[model samples]
Target: MNRNRAKWLTLMTLVLLTLTMSAQNKQKFKVVLDPGHGGKDTGTNHLKNVEKDIVLAVALEVGKILNKESDIEVFYTRSKDVFVPVKERSVMANEAKGNVFVSIHCNGVASSSPSGTETYVMGLSKNKSNLEVAKQENSVILMEDDYKTQYAGFNPSAPESIIGLMLIQEDYVQQSIDLASRVQDGFTYDLKRKNRGVKQGPFWVLHGAFMPSILIELGFVSNKEEGAYLSSSKGQKELAKSIAQGIISYKNAYYNNGIAHTETNVNEPQANTKSAVKGVTFKIQIAASSRVLALKPQNFKGLSNVTMEKGKKINKYFYSETSDYTEAKQRLAEAKAKGHSSSFIVAYKNGKQIPLEEALK
Candidate 1:
């Protein structure tokens, strides 16, 4: 090769290698640390004081540690004692391109006996207490009229509470769950606190976040002992360290596995709301020895409007009313898609099961 061509080739190769290394070294973890209820809005207060101060102290310490210890860039919603509305915090974090958001708060209940660390992610709640807690936490939105717009139009009622969660529609759901689990474990093992498993519910602060977000209630302020621990400097350091480590460990798993793609989120509910079609009457089974003629009127007189279809090696039954022609066709389509052609209904009339004829009228 000519000297000029050889020199150009060497330069091009060096340029390509540099770009590749830069892409590989790009930051994999970007976190937003939110200390719940600041300034005038002192969330839930104990005899010692409000939860706002406790969470801020912990969040500040956590952010400092994350910045000093790891390559992760931690964004804070508030750095000092100031009121940051729910809408503003979410907007600021998203603007900063945060990948994950962690909201820190202290749990509270009327009874001084209740104590534990509960972590919440956006979703529907099933329990009454959980629903109440959701409402209490979510009320922070009242401070902002545009909170609805801030969270990408998340509806507190019906489906809106669940649908807006689609933005994170990637593998982050499981990753968020894993991080929450680790934090709970850390609280139990390292901090000697009660562990509440990762829970799903609607939180105003989390509803609009485009990335994986979690709200952590680190022990009940209602309980005297727990409140005291949360107020102390040593307890603050311990709590912050445990939470930061959980995030580090979780992010390490993804980076270690070389997972560059985001996870898909299944936010929408399925159209088929589970029906309450009860009773053994709903189930129709056939006998192993039953023949196609078993579907005949005289053979199965008591059975009403039974439909049957000839199977490759067996017969199938269907209920003329509930499992009508249209439903049968849809199920057949689903079965065919799954490579299963033996998709048919079997009816149980009396004690015998009719096969081919039993599945059809």
Candidate 2:
């Protein structure tokens, strides 16, 4: 009787282990693609070059390209010409547990001079043009029912109102910038579009997402030449291909060989001993998630000194802290070696994050 019971227990344990491993193997990288402005919202219409139709077409094409990859799963906020509330788009991405959220849009103005691609990550910026873009996109809240209550009295025209939204994205800002940069690079090198460079703006759609998010302005629809190209099938396909390739590049860098790069490691402390800089602290950001993990070596793959910054919806995890810039780079390399391939050095001065360049100086 004892031998039979032991055999049964062994069989059940092996079966459970196999199931867990299979589930892990089947995990796919999710990409949430949001096609900006649909249904009642025509977006920026310039001489019949409708923004809604163009963005939707391009987004669908991009999703189709990405869906071809076996390891990537794509989700669309709206698959057709339907109105989707701005906030709901983000809620969908969060619910899907998306690795990244991309909102596709087109720029327009009364004047037809500006004609280039601009990719934006959520943040507070003083740039007037960037703020205007945010305001234009955020104005869609007005189309939703009970806009004032839904958005908590967010006034799109008043840029100051967006300052509160910026905090929601603070944890993922670095990752968002990396993704945005890749997208902008694709537009510049692959499509030969004018490089407007990656900029920071308080985009409501991007801020509400827990993961890295970007808002892409494909090009100015107001320009006659650009509008004609954007509306054509050939041009849309080319743009979609570039955008897909950019996402693939980002995924390849961060995801690496079918394994998600976010897995933490518990290893010997990697911060090098070096001379300290006055009023400067450097930390390597390893990961950020909605999960609040205990600061334990066991939790972080045996790494000690792992700290987390808790936020309302997201938390940021970091490894090692030093005042030496060179040591910070060394720590960053160690983190990448430990499988945090997307990790980057974050510098601080007097409790505030500042540019690494300024911190070094």
Best-fitting candidate, measured by lDDT? Answer: 2
- Model 2 score (lDDT): 0.83
Tens-place lDDT per residue, model 2, 1-361, is 9999999999999999999998787788899999999999999999789999999999999999999999999999999999999989999999999989999999999998989998988877766887899999999999998899988888998967865564687667768876887788889988899988788788888878998899999998899999999999998999999999888877865663345554321112235523466889989888765467999877766667899977433467899999876677788878777766667776789987654545544
Score each candidate by Cα lDDT: 0.64, 0.83
Residues forming the 10-long window of minimal summed lDDT in candidate 1: 261-270
* TM-scores, each model vs. reference: 0.64, 0.75
User: 120, model 2: CA deviation in Å?
Assistant: 0.2
State in Å the error of residue 17, model 1: 4.1
Give a tens-digit lDDT track for model 1, residues 1-361: 6999999999999999999887767654677999998877888887875789999999999888888754588889998788898867778878978767899998887889988888876655455556667767766665665766765665554344543344332224434554676677788888788876677665767756766678899888889988888888988899999999888765654342223332111111134522222221222222111136656534433444556645322234443433333343444344334433222332334433322222332
Model 1 whole-model lDDT (C-alpha atoms) = 0.64
How far off is residue 208 in model 1, in Å?
1.7
Error of 1 at 87 (Å): 2.8
